[model samples]
Target chain A: MTRKHLSTWGAVIFIAAIPIVIAANSPLLQWRDPVYIAGGFAGIIAMALLLFQPLLAAGRLPGLSLAVARRVHRWLGAALILSVFAHIGGLWITSPPDVVDALLFRSPTPFAIWGVIAMWALIATAILALARKRFRQNLRYWRAAHSALAIVIVSTTAAHAVMIEGAMGTMSKAALSGALCVALLVALNDLRVWKRTRPGRGITTD
Target chain B: MTKLHMNRRTLIASSGAVLATGVAGGLAPARAQSLAPTQSMRGGSNNYRPGAPIVERIGGGGFWMTGTVRRAGDGAPLSGQRIQIWAHTTEGHERDWHSHGATLTDANGVFRLEMPQIVPAFGQPHGHLAYDSEEFETVFLRPVMSSARDTTLEAHFVLQPA
Candidate 1:
C-alpha cells in the first residue's frame, strides 16, 4: 500500500524470483555451459536485492532479521559478480568466436548487447559501492548511482531473456518474463515514491 | 482481515488440490511423448544378426569402415542389403530431402561403399535419404564414426556418422 512497503516487496520478489524466472527460459538449461549458468545465477541474485530490500525495510522477519537479509543481499551481489565471470569464461572456452562476437556486440542476436550492458552496469554499481569509503558519505548520491545501475542491470537481463530462443521452454520464458514485470513494477513504484517524497527535486525519471 | 485470511486459506487449499490433480493427469502423456518414436527407434542393437556373408568396404570417413547393418526391426540379415544412399544437402536445398548416398549390408549387416570427394557447402554437403515407407524411413549417413574422424572423405569410413 505505502511506497516503502511496495519497494520492500518489490525488491524481495525480484531477488527471490530471479532463479525461477531464469529457469523458465529453456535454452539456458539445455547446453549446460558454465558461463550461461553462472550468468543466470548472478543475474537472479542481483535482481533479488530489489525484492529483499523492501521486505527487510518493512521489518518482516523472524530469524536473523534485517542484518541477515542485508548480508544475504550483499552476498548474493558478490556471488552474482563471480557467476557472471564464470559465465563469460565458460562462453570463451566453449566458443571463442561466438564470445568474440558477443563482446564486440556484433553477434547475430540482440541479447549479446543486452548481456554486455548488464555486465558493465553491474560492475559500475559494484565499483561505486566498494569505493564508498573513499568517496563522500552522501547517501543520496550512493542511492541514486546504485538504483540507476541496478535498473540497467535488470532491464538488460530482461532483454537478454526476451532475445534468447533456446532450451528455456515456454514455461521458463513466461516465468522469467513474469519476474521481470514484477521487478519493473517495483522500480516504477520506487519512482512514484521518490516523486511524492521529494516534489520538485532534480531526480531525472530514468 | 479475518475474512481475507479465510479466503486466502481457501484459495491456497483449492490451488494445492488443482496442482495435485494436474500432475497426476499429466504423467501418462508425458511418458508416452518421451517414449514416442525418435530417430534412434529406427535402429537398435540385438536387431542385427550374424550368419550372412559380411561385405566390408570403406564408407566415407577419415578411417576405414568396420561395422554391420541388419533388416529393420527383425535383426534378420537382408543378406546382401543393397542400400542406395542419396539425399539433399543438410541445408535442405532445392535438391530435395529424399535422396542420400546408400550401401548394402551382408548377413552381418556390414557393407561399405567408397565415398566420393565432397566439397563443403554453407550448411553441409552430403548424401541424405530418398524414400521409405512410414514404417521404415531412409535416414542420413556419415562416412566415418564420430569419435576419431575429421576428414570429410566419402570413403574409408570407420563408422556411419548418421
Candidate 2:
C-alpha cells in the first residue's frame, strides 16, 4: 500500500480505538459489573461502526469497491443493530426498570430519551435498507428519506452518547461525536441524496 | 462519633439561621431553589456497591467527601437519606472496598464523610458518590476536583421522586 493509503487507514483506526482505550483506562471501571462493561463496550463499538458506515456508503474508504463497500456497509449495519441490542440488553441486565422506563419514554434522564429516539430511527433505517429493491421504484424519494433518517440517527445517537458520563473520557467522546457528524455530512453531501428530490426536478437516472 | 453531623446541628440550633450561599458551618445550601434533579450519568456507577457501610470516616479520617441531598423540583433537604461515598484516595484506588463507605444527610439535607485525601486517578481528581435509596430515584455523581492537590471533594445530589 502507498503512504497515503496507510495514513488513511491509520486515521480511521485512531478514531475508532482512541475513545475505547481512554474509557478502558478510566478509574471508575473497577467497581463496574461484568455485564455493564460488556454493554458499554458494545455501545462504543457501535459508535465506531457509525464512523465507518457513512464512509463506506459514500465510497470514501480507500480500499473497497462500491460493491464490496455496499456489502460491508450492510454487514456493519447489521452489526450496529446487534451492538445496540447488546448495549441495551447489558444495561437491562444491570437495571431493568431504567431501561423499561427509557423504552417507554417515561425515564427522567435526558440521555434515555435521546437514546430511544436514535434506536427507533436506526430500526427504521434498517427497514429502508432491507426494502431497497422495492424502493428503487422511487429511488430519489427513498434516498432522500433514508438520508433524512440517517441524519436523525447520527445526531440523536451522538447526543445520547455524549450526554452520558460513563466510562468514556469526555474529550475523546466529544471528538468521536464530532467525527461522527463530520463523516455523516461528508457522506450525505457526496451521495447527493437531496440533489433532485424537489419541486422543480423530475426523477433522473443514476 | 460524627464531627461533621454534630457540628452542623449545633451550628443550626445556636444560630437559628445563617447565610444562604456561604459555607458557614455545616449548612450545604440555603440556595436549594437552584438545585435540580441530577441525571444519573452513564458509566458513572462503575464501582458502586449496593450497601456501602455507614462510616464515620474511611481510612481513619483527614479528607472530606461532602455534599447536599435534596428532593428534586422542590429541593427540600432530604433528611436521613443515605448517600454512599467512595473515591480513589491517598490510601488506595476507588475500586478497593476499603475506599468506599456511606453517610446520611443531616436535618439540613447536608451529608459529609471523612476519608483519606483523594488522589488523582487517570489524570483526574474525582470522587464517586451515589444516592440509591428506595424512596428516591438513584443518582450517581462523579465529581472531579479542579486540582488533584485539593483536600476536599463535594458532590451534591438532587433526587427525583421514585
Candidate 3:
C-alpha cells in the first residue's frame, strides 16, 4: 500500500486504540457498578469526542474531504451533547445531591464544577449550532459566539477530566485531555476564529 | 497544501507543550478530599431483620452493589449475616422510602443488593449499608460513594465480633 494509505490506517488505529486502552485500564471493570460504569463510559466518550471536534473542524483527518469533515464535526458535536447527558444523568441517578451541588455551583469538588461548566457550554454551543439559520443576518457574530462557546467547552472539559481520579488512568487521560485542549486551540487559531477578519477577506455580510 | 503542513506542524508542537504541562499539573495530588463526607441514615428507619437470608434483588433499574462479609481478623466468611442498605433516589426521601431494604449473606458470606435509581440527597452521591447481627457488632457503612463506571460494585465488609 502507499504511504498515504498507511498513514490513514495508522491514524484510524491510534484513535480506536485510545478508548479501548483506557477502558481496559479503568477500575470500572473491578468496581462493577452499572450506573457508575455507565456514567464513567459517558465521560470517556465525551473526552474522546473532544479529540475529534478540532480535527474535524480543521479538516485534519488524513483521508476525509473537507465537506465530510464538516459533516462529521456536526454529528460529533451532537454525540458529544448526548454523551454529556448520559454522564450527568447516570451520576444524577446514582446521587442527586451531588448533581444538584454541581449544578448549583456549590459542589466542593472542583471537577464537578468544571464538568458542569463544560456541560452547559456544550449545550449552549449545540443550541447555537442548531439555530445557525436564524443567525444568517449576522454571520460574524454567530461565528464568534460559536467559537467562544467552543473554547469554553474545550477548556472546561479538559479541566473537568483532568481533575477526576476515576475511570481513565491518569497518564492516558491527561494525554488525551491535553491533546484535545491543544488541538482545539490550534485549530481555532489557524482558522482565525480568535482573530478579527480583514475587511475584504471573505467576511460574509448578510 | 504547504499551509496545511505548517498548521499540522504547529498543532504537533503545541500539543507536545500541552502534554508536558498537563502531565505535570494533572499528576499533582488533588487538594480536595477524595471521599465525600459520611452522612447519617439512622433517622430514617430500622428495617433490620434476622430470617432465612432475604436474597431477592430488592429494586430494579439501578446498579448492583455486591460484596462479601468476612471476619476482620481471620478473614473467614460471615455467613447468614443480615446486611441492610438504603439510599435516596430521584423520588423524595419521604417516610417508608422503598429504597431501603435488607438481605442475608449466602453460605459463602456473599450478598448482592440492587440499588434503586439513586439521587443525591445532601451534596454527595452516597448510599448506606450496615451489617447487623447478634454475634457481630453493628457495622454501619454510611454514605458509600457510588462508583462512576462499574455495573456492580464489589464492596467487602469486615465485621468485629460483638
lDDT of 2 at A30: 66
Q: Individual DockQ of the candidates? A: 0.02, 0.07, 0.04
What is the clash tally of candidate 3?
A: 17
Off by over 4 Å in 1: A1-64, A184-206, B1-162
**iRMSD (1 decimal) for each model:** 16.8, 8.6, 9.9
Instruction: Write down the lDDT that model 2 would get.
Output: 0.78
The CAPRI quality class of candidate 3 comes to incorrect
Candidate 2 chain B, run of 10 with poorest lDDT: B1-10
lDDT of 3 by residue, A1-206 (tens): 67986886576446535765777675334533567668778888888877888777776666777678888989999899899999889877765655777899866567788888998899999899889899877776788898888889888888887767565666777777777777777677656775665343223332
| Ordered list by lDDT, greatest first | 2, 3, 1
* Best of the two (2, 3) by TM-score: 2
Number of the candidate with higher DockQ, 2 or 3:
2
The numbered model that scores best in lDDT is 2
Write one digit per residue (lDDT tens) for candidate 2, span A63-127: 77777887898999999999999999987776565577789887646777898898999999899
User: Which one wins on DockQ?
Assistant: 2
Q: Where in model 3 is the C-alpha error above 4 Å?
A: A1-9, A12-16, A198-206, B1-162
Tens-place lDDT per residue, model 1, B47-93, is 12112222232223322223344333233433444444332222222
Candidate order by TM-score, highest to lowest?
2, 3, 1
Query: B1-162, model 2: which lDDT tens digit per residue?
Result: 111223565567535544533445666645444334677655457567788899888987788888888776566888999999887666765667898899999999999899987765432467788888899888887777877668888877778888
Q: TM-score of the B chain in model 1?
A: 0.33
